[model samples]
Target: MIGRLNHVAIAVPDLDAACAQYRGALGAVVGAPQDEPDHGVTVVFVELPNTKIEFLYPLGDNSPITGFLEKNPAGGIHHICYEVDDIMAARDRLQAEGARVLGSGEPKIGAHGKLVLFLHPKDFNGCLIELEEA
Candidate 1:
């Protein structure tokens, strides 16, 4: 089952500008940008008192974020991540419940270096959901 809210991911066409908005305007503590080749995104995390905000930018032409940006030129909330105590168990239970998992249905290393899996947006009321191992 899902645990605490891990982070909310926002797709951004311009990483620098988004970072500036969060760091300068919002006065948030922005972390360094990290390129996640597996996820095909360059990310920067804005830490907060309770949770974190992730800014996602396309890393390559084939990046998923690129497609998302194509659909939404201004970019938007890409996904919401929730922590799980046991990712595999969570996957199985969700699968049995008829929820579709995205990709290979296996956990991948996420930005926090933790195992993560993405569920299909259609299965989660049009919002992509990410489950990260806690």
Candidate 2:
């Protein structure tokens, strides 16, 4: 099942600007930008006391974020990530409940280098949900 809230991902039109806003304006601890080719996103993490904020930018024209940005030019909350003890078990349970998993329905390496899977937004009340193995 789900564990702690891993991070909240936000799609950004400008990753640098977003990181600057958190680093300069908010004085938050911002991590270096990392490109996740599998996910097709360049991400930066803003660390918080309890959780983290992820800023996502399109890696290429074919990136999934590109489509998201096209629909929402200003960008918005892309997804909410939750940690799970066993990703396969969680996926199976969710599937039994008729929840659809995004992509190949297999876990992929996330920004944290952990196993991660994304559930369909429509299945989770319009909010994309990411389950990362804890």
Candidate 3:
């Protein structure tokens, strides 16, 4: 159902400092900040040879990242996204297997401009999982 690991998302309180750490200290190729209003996050993608690292910051008052940051003030890994060949098929399979899908059980446009869906963290060993159309 899931393909390659898409990216690991990290929720951060300070977006600027996070980007600077990756860019200056790690010497990584960090991309520009992109506002995902629907998802309510401002994301910065750090490109790497194997996979990408997504830095997520709150975009609005009700942004999910806001709550995440509140729980983890220092920020931490928010979710791990995996690619799927067919998102609907993957969703169906997971649902049949008693997995809970987050939100409306519908795919949303992700930061990569692709259809994405989030699964309940509890079902996945307490680690939030995101599935993106490959």
User: What is the C-alpha lDDT profile of model 3 across 34-130, one tens digit per residue?
Assistant: 9988889999999999999999999977898988888999999999999999999999999999999999999988878999999999999999999
Q: What is the TM-score (0 to 1) of candidate 3?
A: 0.96
lDDT of 1: 0.92
Cα lDDT, all candidates: 0.92, 0.92, 0.94
lDDT of 1 by residue, 1-134 (tens): 67899999999989999998989999999999999887789999999999999999999767889988999999999999999999999999999999999989989888789999999999899999999999
Give candidate 3 regions above 4 Å deviation: none
**TM-score-better candidate, 1 vs 3:** 3
User: Per-residue lDDT for 1-134 in model 2, tens only?
Assistant: 68899999999999888988999989999999998887788999899999999999989667988888999999999899999999999999999999999999989888788999999988889998999999
Instruction: State the displacement of the C-alpha of residue 116, model 2, in Å, after optimal TM-score superposition.
Output: 1.3
Q: Best candidate per lDDT, number?
A: 3
Candidate 2 lDDT: 0.92
Estimate the TM-score of every prediction. 0.95, 0.93, 0.96
| Two-way lDDT contest, 1 vs 3, winner | 3
Give the lDDT of residue 65 in candidate 3. 91
lDDT of 2 at 105: 93
